[model samples]
Target: MKRSKALKVETMFNNFKLTFFLQPLHGLPETLSDTANANWPWQQDINWFLALAEFKRLTQQPTLHFFLLEVWSEHTRCLALPLCSTKDGRYWSSLTDVYSPSFNIISSTTLIIANPWQCLLHALTQLQPNWVYCQLSPLRQEQIQQLTKLNGCLRTHVFEHSENWLANCSSNQEYWHKRPGQLKNTIKRKRAKLLSSGSRIEIHSQLTDELMLKYWQVYQQSWKQPETDRYFINWLANYSAANGMLRLGLLFIDEQPVACQLWLVHHSKAAIYKLAQDQAFDNLSPGTVLMADMVNYVIDIDKVTSIDFLTGNDNYKAMWMDFNFKLYGAELFNINSLTGRWLWSKQWLKTTLKTIARQMHHLIFRARHDN
Candidate 1:
């Protein structure tokens, strides 16, 4: 199989150099800062090999291997990884590494050296695996379009929307204050109720292992109801503990946990990775109150440039978000190969069928409503 070529140490400065490398977790660079203006959440910089190693150690998964690409610039450095899970029970490949690529459409020279789509195509063509996956920030539309054009790639699926709202610290406060309308009224009512009942919302930076375990229990119970599996919760807890950029924002009412959110600081942006709410307190809107507080906290206290609601296309995200971008998943292969050609044809037929089915469903539903 043709693995991506690695650039020689001497010619690393030449035009658009590329390399494929691997290292152990213990051998990670002492600090991500050593790589010139790299993003925060230092654990992401631990080198792809080390990150995977730590993941393996904590999760005890023995069949995983890491493939990484290092991209360099005069003012910045970044890394990408093609993660493959070879475990008997698990089956998938992902493009999720630590640091995210810079997204400025203009003046972002980093793309010359690191093209994640190209790297992924090479991996797929060589491996010819079951599926390739990556969670792209909804903001990168150009990148998505480029990947969609790949010869044998198919966009198998995508999550519909996010349930949270993301915004920048510098956004107009007055606008936000007036935007929520009835939702805002509900929040105030909930806060008044909590206070009247002698309860208070307290945010914490550090949590005990026992508390963390409790948070996980709530998270697992909520997560299991969904069609997707929560495979990364365990890895996230350990990773957040090891990396300072990761934080847990918890809301406690009278010393008992009511809500918790897992947040990560990357570059100048904050991401709401996971959230859980206590079922007993659902009537009081504890989750909403915690989210509202967290939003203000990130903007006022942390001073991040933006917040990402992550994957979903939820209505709440649209309500408060001033910006949004579409996300796509695609598969690529060598079109000339027999298997690749067959898979591509299958995808086209499936997509066509889906479109027809959707239209028919809509028509039938409309007729029933009319009747």
Candidate 2:
């Protein structure tokens, strides 16, 4: 029987049946809330997927086709793969967005499932014969390495996305001391100037209804690009505020809102989610001053272990968050499809050429060193 793009796979992986459920966790035989292998509950649990579904709905984004691939050994489930296919049904991805910090696939660490990655690929290949690509992203280096190393697909390629920045806060004094002198001097000068110019500035932390109104007002006047979904940011602020994770900071100049930043604190880590500052306040450097104060607040007041400047490799980010972890993504290609085949070959050739170039450079370096 010919299968459609939304076809399900019921393949056997060494006797373990790989079943794809059309619904979310409700379709699963058992909840993975208490799964023994769940290290990162936020990323791996059933609730996270449900939240993503709700987020999409609330944001009015196109609904994705959710897939719950459960691997069962006899009647006991070994692992579950939570996946979301795009509206076009050609690409498979995680239930993640720009806001999602990371992604994960729950698997039993104790279970000796030989070549589970291969089984996953086989099942996907059979289910979506015309599948062009797959991407699971915002993953750490270890996570990316695991997928690429265990990959059974010949055309899978790994790509570095960004250098996610982090600030280790031993203390406010220590953290500030390590900062570049130029940064400190600029903030000091700009802040003093703003104050002396009779521009009374105030920074607020609460996401109250009044503050929320001021936030959107200033954000519109800011230099930052417009958000694709404006409602999602507002929703995120409310959600984070309810969870006591919202650290939405608004900077005002004489009662007029000039700058606003969206930050979230959770699990003893503070993330700099979003920030916007009015271009009219560029001379005052409200962004820089606000950031400095926020940093001090997160460390001395909030007592967060670390401050994450998530999802950017901006030059200024390096000055504040000195330490960084590289985030990566992988592209999986199907050799059976013509477009996929070309993509695979091109990627292969690019990789091989890079390898050759590096080897040649190494050889030349060695000969030069001998001289």
Candidate 3:
């Protein structure tokens, strides 16, 4: 059965009436795939969210409740954000930092109203989600301020989430040339070594059970953390392949797959979603060899305009990317609740303790130097 917040229950302010409801994931909205509002349909579309939600339900926690959070004013929709949380609405996050590339909210009008963000605050006043409310992450700094100021919720906190890397592709040759000399030499040496050691390499735009099996085997052999939702990547592979955006690369040494990468190419942009290199092949740099080849293919053959390294500020990502961007998020809790106050107090106490410890360490060091 589909569950919705009661239609009669509404919030009215500034001549605008808001009627929002929590909808389940079983009925994903069609507007989720609207490309007009998305930068990457592959990641922003309904399929991606469904895959993530279903993976959570099947692998991690109890059943998750998805809400189609929409705001309306006399029939005109003002804001639409897809939200997922526990049935009780606690411990919620708008986007999975690992899986999602970006955050999105859609509406015919702006979210400048007084009550757009108060939806959660209202619930808290009525004591719906009592603690550890929701986090909306990877938002722009401006967006963070706007949402925090507009929401009546008192326990709102803004956090810097990640440092991500990206590059604007012009030509594969130029891209290679622009890279550091040391990286270029490393790639050259690794490619020569792999080729001399009898390596088989290929990039596939199609998805097959056999190829996925090889990827899983490589993942197990590689340094990646073990997956709880084993079929999550398989679902992504199937979807990306069917859309002709799949870019799977693998390198095998002595008939054994040692390294693999999964990239998605859509709308003239290529995103490096996942990659793995077996620890055994770390000396040979199989991961680097395979990545260079696929990057070349996506740039020279697929003609992508940009390449996204996706989530992370890893030392390796900065080596290849032309620039980096900061991602921010907002954590919202109702200060009216005791749990909320405790949470804020705990943060303040922690910060104060760190400051005191640092000051003592500095003074002690000065005294030691004088002695």
| Candidate that would win on lDDT | 3
TM-score for each candidate, following the candidate numbering: 0.66, 0.77, 0.83
| Residues 265-321 of candidate 1: C-alpha lDDT, one tens digit per residue | 656677877778878777877777777877777666667778777666667766556
Span of ten consecutive residues with least summed lDDT in model 2: 23-32
The clash numbers for all candidates, in the given order, read 10, 0, 0
lDDT of each: 0.52, 0.71, 0.73
User: Once superposed on the true structure, which residue ranges of model 2 sit more than 4 Å away at CA?
Assistant: 1-19, 22-82, 86-88, 106-130, 151-154, 197-206, 336-339, 353-371
lDDT of 3 by residue, 1-371 (tens): 23554323466656556665444555322323544235565334656666666776677755666555555556666665666766656556783636776675654444466444555445333434464666887776666766677544466677788867999878998788778988889989998999899998989999889999999999998888999877677877887787788899999998889999999998788999999999988999999889889989999889998999977789988778899888888877656667767776786677679889999999999999999
Which candidate's TM-score is highest? 3
Give the range of the ten consecutive residues with the poorest summed lDDT in model 3: 28-37
lDDT of 3 at 205: 97
Q: Is candidate 2 or 3 superior in TM-score? A: 3
Better of 1 and 3 by lDDT: 3
Point out the worst 10-residue segment of candidate 1 by lDDT: 98-107
